[model samples]
Target: MRHRRGLVRLWDYAKPSWRRLTLALLCMGVEAVCVPLMIWTAKELLPPILQSGQSQALRRLDLVALAVLALGLLKGLASYGHYYLGNYVGQRVIQGLRGDLFWHLLRLSPRFFEETRSGKLISHLTNDVAVLQQVLSENIAQVLVTPLMALGTVVLMFLLSWRLTLLVLLGAPLLAWVLQQMGRKMRRVTERMQQRLADLTSLFQEVVLGIRIVQCFNAEERERQRFGAENERTFAAIMKGHQLQALMTPTIEWIGLTGMLLLLWFGGREVILAQRMGAEDLIALLGSVQVLITQMRKFGRLHLILQQGRAAGQRILEVLDLPPEIPQKPNAIALPDIQGHIQFDHVSFQYSSGEMVLHDISFEVRPGEVVAIAGPSGAGKTTLANLIPRLYDVTSGSVRVEGYDVRDWDLASLRSHIGIVPQEVLLFTGTVRENIAYGQPEASDEEVEWAARMAYAHEFIVRLPQGYQTWVGERGAKLSRGQCQRIAIARALLRNPRILILDEATSALDSESETLVQKALERLMEGRTTLIIAHRLSSIRHAHRILILDQGRIVEEGSHEELLGRGGLYSKLYELQSLQARGEGLE
Candidate 1:
């Protein structure tokens, strides 16, 4: 069920910037009081100025006007002050949330990324957060001030003439009814607006990120159609919201005008008959009526703003309420200096659907031992490697590093001891030196060069137009896959972690690049406990042990020669590859 959560929850973001919020409210309060106070002062002096019937009395009227103008000037200054403080608080809160979201994303399990679309998550972080910002800084600030202003105007009008005020008062319930219905409609529409906007943002993200794929697959027209449909839906939602609001302003104004006309006929008769009220009192009453009308119109619009803000606030609260899936336990012990002993003891896991990905797998690697895992596509080789880093806790067993369960160790210290090179080498747009030194940001120039040379990337980097200073371009699109892989290897080497996992580190490279990367890998794996996930038989030939995985279990385990000699699944795979290499057809 979609519950109606309000602005009280939205104020949680202001906790970090409470001082700014307080100052903004203070400014708003001062302005709210000033509006009616200025009106009351205008009403007070007008009687004396008109009845005196002298030039000096006209001077008093001029003075009263000047005082009213000064109050208005103060109100303008206060409005600016309110806006400045509100926006400052809003921006600070947004910055805090963004920082937390980025850190949390780094900690999420790899499966989290697989299930959640990147475009949708990006929409949450960017577009959704921005909508909440507009609500917090602009609309919410007005919500606080407008109600006080409207109530103040009503009270002043009542004091001026209770009789006419009663008639205006009669319309109050009707106005409230109008606002109530419109606010409810606006809230519903606002939620739809936010959802549609997120869809639009996701569409744009998908199109931009997969522009190459879209073009290659001749899906340009299809994507365009999809995006246009999304945009139309967004436009429709916005128009529906505005349509309700459009009715609001005109209806409130017409009601206020009807009250004003009633006041003119009734109050003018009181003045003409020389009743209890004077001409000046009638004027004051009319003036108060004018102030009431203006405030009521503003009040109606404020309802729409508040409803929109409330809807936005609810969306933001949902994100803030999502408990971290992997929170640090209280008093978690810091991991000791790792000697890279890793063990997976009867580890088992499944996806959210409970379809098992890894069975009761058990394995151990001593310090400085090299293990290679080969598998069919659906086997759990990658899952087993991931368990060591504590990316996902085992469903039934334990993964330990250096004798301590990874869950008991400080997550930061545990991750710091491990380095990983993924199958997809994602390079950011930065200098070659920067990319290589990413793993060890504070590494000196000599250390960077040493790591790059070990990875066989230094020679090619120096041969480029700007040497180490050359930009890699977006996702390293300017560099060959081999060059990007070499840089990734250099980054891992610079980290000099106690444990390293290379997932198909050289699979995409040509033979020449593979030879270079292999030499670099040899240097990198020298003293570290290394686990390699490989498809090519030659990559695992030198490993001390190789485990062949199929259907989430180890089907074969031995050295490459032993596996071949066994003549099982590994031998058949090897034979198929040997035949392909010799230009023989598959049977």
Candidate 2:
């Protein structure tokens, strides 16, 4: 039943290309008709050449040969059209499906990505889709054409000699039962194989993204062993699928051949011994039987392809079926221009697993206020900042922006006015200029340069080989950490967002790099409602107010000087950091 649904979904994907599919089916029909005609002409040509009169036999042979040649030509032309159009339709369907999958993935909430492996998603996009493409490109044509060819041949055989045709068809039920059982097993095996492949891909991606950590710890051999184990599992699953396919093909062929042997024995006896059937008729019956057997074998192979495709299609559909965790409502309105007044009113939040991350978090940041959120690690500082942009809707209470609940605003419009610069800045594989203008693609060259200048990135960018056009390697590997951060800031600056969330943006840099980035960040925060999630106490000293959190609730809210005077959790944390900075031990 699941496989049936998958096939229906696949057909829906194919609906847009009905014209090409219709033309391909017509070509297949023409080709199917020509096969029987060619076989009949051969049978007719045989009897004429065997006649005693040479001139009459030669004349008949010429006409039959011409008829056979014309049929072959027409069949070849139709075959070409069938193959070309079928593949064209297949490519179109896969392209649309792949594109839709990607678009859907992009619209999914960040939590979805946090829970799902990048490798598994990448496998769905590339490997699984490629498997489905094989069904569309090649197997689909065989699926349609082979059955038609087989049916036409069966009809011709029955017309010539029903008894022989009936004898050959006695194996049909057995062959079908074998196909059904093997195909079920093949689907199971193929699904497992795809899962193993996804695991292998996930492991490889995890290792590559963390190669530095692996090399630093000298765990290359350990990683290799882990990868080898996964590869072996994938190999085993693939070989199991291959074994089923190998066993099925010959099992089906043997059944078909057994039926053919029975037909030959019975029909040959009737022709030679009883003289109940003519030689020409027996010959044509044999020809038709060969075509039928070939079609049956093709059907067996097509079944395997269909099983594999169904497995792949199921995987792809699983992703498409997921509703976006943060879906926008039909009545959601565009976020109007605001002065960046963000308020969290009795807000509490939790993940999908029901582990509460924030509790009764009430805060109000007036327009252009720089509110620093200081906390120890895992204190929900970042989570609190995330609520402002509606990355995750609150579990119970409301988060409002400019007097409107964020849930009432369009997601895109809400996020467009916000900018984030995380501690781990990620730059795409593109030019430095492109990275800066990523948020605002239509930014003029001068605007990009101006943002770069504001972020203090213009000097280093201009020093690169191609200036702004210099290609930053993956994740900005070619640039320094400080350079990447500044570029990220420049990206935010270019968008000129009304609100900014700096989640430890300067936490990962050395003193020299941090100094430069901090200066750039100060320029970025001017006249914007900013939420700075920072662990370093020194960075928030100049903020208008600091909200210190512990265990998912605000423990202290005051200016840095006021918090220092209070001697609460904030003071203790500040004292610890101060002692560490001064190279002193805490007693």
Candidate 3:
């Protein structure tokens, strides 16, 4: 039942390319026909043409030779058409699938990514997709051509000599057994190989992404060993499949040869002893036997390829089957121009595992209010702010923006009205202007410049070798952390969001960079409803209200000065920061 569904889904994807598939199939059919004709013509016509008197033989030979040449020409043209059009369809379908998969990724909630590894997702897009291409380009033709070739050859062999053909047919059961075993083994091996590939990819992604940490900790050798282990696993898995593929060809060859040896014995007896068969008849039967052997071998090989492709298709299906966790409510209205009166009303939340991370957290930021949430790590401060943007839905109760339950708003428009500058600023490998204007791609150059200036990112951008046009290497690795942070700010600034989220945005920068970012934040925050999650006590001093969270609950709430006077979680956090600063001579 499952297998049927998978094949049905695959056919749906192929249906759009039916015209190309039809053309390729036609070419495959032509090639299949040509192979047996060429062999049969050579076996029957060549000897007869020779036996004729020289003058008559010359005339027959010319026609026979031309006919054979024409078959070869047709075969070559059809083979070329089969391969080229097959690739066109395969590539086109793969392009569409990749696009759909990527868009699906965009639709998936953060929860999906939280559980799925980056490398595995990438493997789905690359190695997995490549296997499907093989299925389309090579396996499809093999499916049509191999069976037809085998059936045709068998029919031709029977016409030449049924008794010898029956001897060949005896090996069919063993040949079928071989293919079945190899397929089962190859299926398991291919799945393992793909998994190993994802592991290697994940390891490489992690090691490359955290190269600084690896180098700083002198863990290069450790990482190399880890990657080497994964590489060896992949190599072993591949060789296992290769061994099965290699074994299939020869085993089937030996089976077919057993049939040939029997034919050689019996057919020779008829020619020399019984005098019942002509040499032409024996030669043609032998030629058909060889053609049958070749096509049977092709069947074994194509079976393994198809099995490998089947494994890949299952992997792709796994992702395609996942429904977007944060699918919006049907008929949800667009969030009207947000007045930014954000409220979290007795909201509780948990991850997919249902372990509560936020417990009945309630808070309100009136329009233009700058509310700061201060908490220890893992205290759910970030999780609380993420709710307003509906990155994840509340487990109970409601989060409202502009007095409407967040679920009521259109997802796109809701997100459009809010901007978040997360702690770890991410920048694309593109120009400064491009990164700054990413949230508002249609923003003009002047607007981009204005936003960059507001974020204090303009100065560094201009000093770049190519100014706004400078290419920021992958994830802005070419720039300093402070520079990346500023660009993230500029990106959010350009959106001119109604509500702003500062998720420890300045927490990682040096004092100088933080000062510049904070100044930019102050200017950008004017009259905007803001939720600030800050670890540093100093950064949130100017916030209209401060909520101190601890272990998923708001333990204290007041302005920074009032919280300090209360001597609670907020004060304890402030004391820790002050002591650490004095110890480091920052005070």
lDDT string for model 3 (1-587, tens) is 44446678767777898998899989988998888888778775766565877787777778888889999999999999988888777777777777878899889999999998776687788878888888877677778888887887787778777877787687667777876777777778877877787677678778888999999999989888888888998999999879877986687668778777878889999889988778888988888878776777678778878877887888888898888888778888785576888888999999887789999888899999999998888999888888888989999989998888998988898999999999888788788888888889999999999999988989888998889999885744388888888888889989999999999988888988889999999988998999888999889999999988888999999988899999887888899998998887854
- Which of candidates 1 and 2 is the stronger one according to TM-score? 2
lDDT of 2 by residue, 49-76 (tens): 6685888888899999999999999999
Off by over 4 Å in 3: 1-4, 49-53, 182-252, 475-477, 582-587
Q: Candidate 2: minimum summed lDDT over ten consecutive residues — where?
A: 1-10
Error of 2 at 153 (Å): 0.5
TM-score (all chains, Cα) for each model: 0.89, 0.93, 0.93
- How much lDDT does candidate 2 score? 0.88
Question: What count of clashes does model 2 give?
Answer: 0
Q: Count the backbone clashes (under 3 Å) in each candidate.
A: 0, 0, 0
Better of 1 and 3 by TM-score: 3
Worst 10 residues of 3 by lDDT: 1-10
* Candidate 1 segments whose C-alpha is farther than 4 A from its true place: 1-23, 43-53, 221-246, 327-336, 473-477, 584-587
